[model samples]
Target: MGLRVQVDNLMEHHSQKSLFAVVLGEMQDGGLPHIGCRCPRCVSGRVGYAACLAIVDVRGAETAVYLLDATPDIKYQLNPLAEWLGPHPQRPNRFNPPTAVFLTHAHMGHIGGLPQLGPEAMAVDGLPVYASAELVALLQETRLWSPMVQGLALRLFSPNQPIPLAPDLTLTPIPVPHRDELGTGTFAFLINGPGKSLLYLPDIDSWQAWDAAHSVLQTVDVALVDGSFYSLAELNGRPPVAHPLISDTLAFFAGWPGELVFTHFNHTNPALEPNSGAVATIQQVGAKLAHPGMRFLLD
Candidate 1:
């Protein structure tokens, strides 16, 4: 399906007095049609934005929208939330910024859109951006990002501590192993709503590396996890990639009770092709591939 169609579908179902999670983008940081690459998926005009998620809470007088990550494709990703976000107070045709944004780590795709919130673009004032203390300090200390950081009220969140968004809605950050070049910790957010809980974990090094993987997965009703590469073949004989293979992920969650869903697909991932064997294997194991517009009701 086309991107517009997917986005329209996402905007179609917005129930009041409810909370839900929506898939804003399902591709890796580079996104589809990766820069300067002539791969089949890239050349075929197939498009996908970097991995991102949005949480919408409509249990009050006004709807509140929170984003899990501010990807490079954030502008397009936020378009579907226009109705919930409402119109900007001063801007004629623009929508207001999200209620807040939580960062998983300091990766390019995770924090790149921050510049868009600076004086150059949205110019949002005092936006609450939550992240690890180290990550927030990194952004504040970097001279190049000072302009954008200055406008944001960056808050530090500790691992495993829950931040309540509403009466029964809380978000807890759980540390995970990943490629950390800047000494900033990576986190997977577990969002607990009234009726259900969902874990947003788009990037991780591997399941085995994290001792709490099984325990954490068992706690949530659904998990949106890293599926960056299907196999080492996608690496073209290079060393193993940071993310765990889809096959291994399926095996790890074979008989789990909770829903297992995959996202953050790399351009070379064969699972991106609807008819690929990789996709078939995922389905056969009762797992799911996340697509734009996919929704999980939290309450």
Candidate 2:
């Protein structure tokens, strides 16, 4: 089998999970079975949580778990990894929180689950959250979100600068063009593991908008990119949004050597259905559709 197939096969075995990155959720901000939408994909009962990735580093004796984004379905997203997180030292029923959370932008799906870390829910204390400098201020200085951030250890990171996690694991924030309504800026993370690199870019306006798209993507071993909408039809005749359609992305990066995986699907996306040709179409182009629990070893 090819490398892509090998990765897919390895991901299917849950018990053997090792140092890797797991695709936690594959839906867009609204997620599948969307808020009041009765689309076929929604009505069919096939749904997924918002786009999220979990990085598990077990290179050392102690395992470190880091989440890429805090989606609305964070409770479900983090539950399955309880073993890795281990039982909280102080809390009887709770598992330890992730090592860190890296936000992509100020979108609802990206930062929506942050409140869960506050007093009412997980009550995480001193948990590190890395984001753009502006985003750090917005979350820290804003009075409205003050309560939720009380226990968070906010860290500001500059775009294109590498934030070292472990000795060899580093996260380089790459500024990508996206609809920045709050002036907080947007970032796509380039996670460099000990032996491999991966890009967890769930949102971007357009590939053409970013001049550095090719070079950055080329360097990564795998890229889980945005697949918000399959076509303009999903828009329901509304004006085009900033996201790059899945069709456009496939053609744009068809020849790129890295393993490309489509994620962040809208509820209207036909690819969510098991028998849909859209899934086959992606495979035909040497790409794969991301599903929850899918794991990819960075090393």
Candidate 3:
């Protein structure tokens, strides 16, 4: 088995314009699938996806990569991550591109990388993709997504079920409310691998949407939650296409029994400018903003 578990917890930062490339994910080859632009709001636009994350294998014999959300800039995003892994040719089967990908919704930013995944591209064999039943069916029935669903096996998972991806890593999908064109069943993954566990729900509409009947907050070691917008009135770009704000989310986590970090930022949100009042407020509540290279060590 391989040895370190890491979450490429990256995000693109911008003020009224672009900021430093703390962990910038660049799109090097091929044009993005949907709309294109060069402005800060366009390039770093929340919907277009300024940053994408790739979860690399730390210890498994299969050096697989699990893509949490495939941002529009994926072609550029995969290059750096692949380079970082380099080629361990001498080591048996150490350089496969990625074993599979897991998507949250049908948003262009989330699944825009699907084309690259087909036979014409990576030519991956049955790259098992995980998503809700509705999301899978929609991808299958739709013209744009039909090829991807057929070219690669799109594994439709039931809400609140667990699927094992590695000897140590299993993904638990927590259903969240969202506006999926097919139907809403946005999943919050409970990724448990060997000794570490992480909870991801980066696109929920609000905390009030959860099932208060159960104590879902204490179920994991760490949470990377929806911080798409800072407030309802921030009224920035594209209205999330449908997602929640940070204010309500932060309050929900105030009583959380585990560590909660935020991700999926919008350009208009003040939190984009680090150390701004918005950033301070989030930190004051004992929560952290998701840092791209952040790693969690489990015993």
Candidate achieving the largest lDDT: 1
Deviating ranges (above 4 Å) for candidate 1: none
Clashing pairs in 3: 1-59, 2-58, 2-59, 2-60, 3-58, 3-59, 9-292, 10-292, 27-76
lDDT by candidate, in order shown: 0.91, 0.85, 0.60
Q: lDDT per residue, candidate 1, 1-299, as tens digits?
A: 76567757766666546789989899999999899999999999888999999999888998999999999998888876788899998889988999999999999999999998888888889999999999999999998887777889999999999999998999999999999999999999999998999999999998999999978877899999999999889999899978999988888888898989999999999999999899998998889999988989999
Q: What is the TM-score of each predicted model, taking all chains together?
A: 0.97, 0.93, 0.75
Say which prediction, candidate 1 or candidate 3, comes out ahead on TM-score.
Answer: 1
Candidate 3: Cα lDDT at 6? 23
Candidate 3 structure quality by residue, lDDT tens digits, 193-265: 6666777666776567677313666667877776667776666344443666677777666677688777777
Sequence-dependent TM-score of model 1 = 0.97
Steric overlap count per candidate:
0, 0, 9
Pairs clashing in candidate 2?
none
Q: CA lDDT of 13 in candidate 2?
A: 61
Ranking by TM-score: 1, 2, 3
Return the top candidate by TM-score.
Answer: 1
TM-score preference between candidates 2 and 3, better one: 2
What lDDT score is found at residue 89 in candidate 2? 92
- Shift in Å, residue 147, candidate 2: 1.2
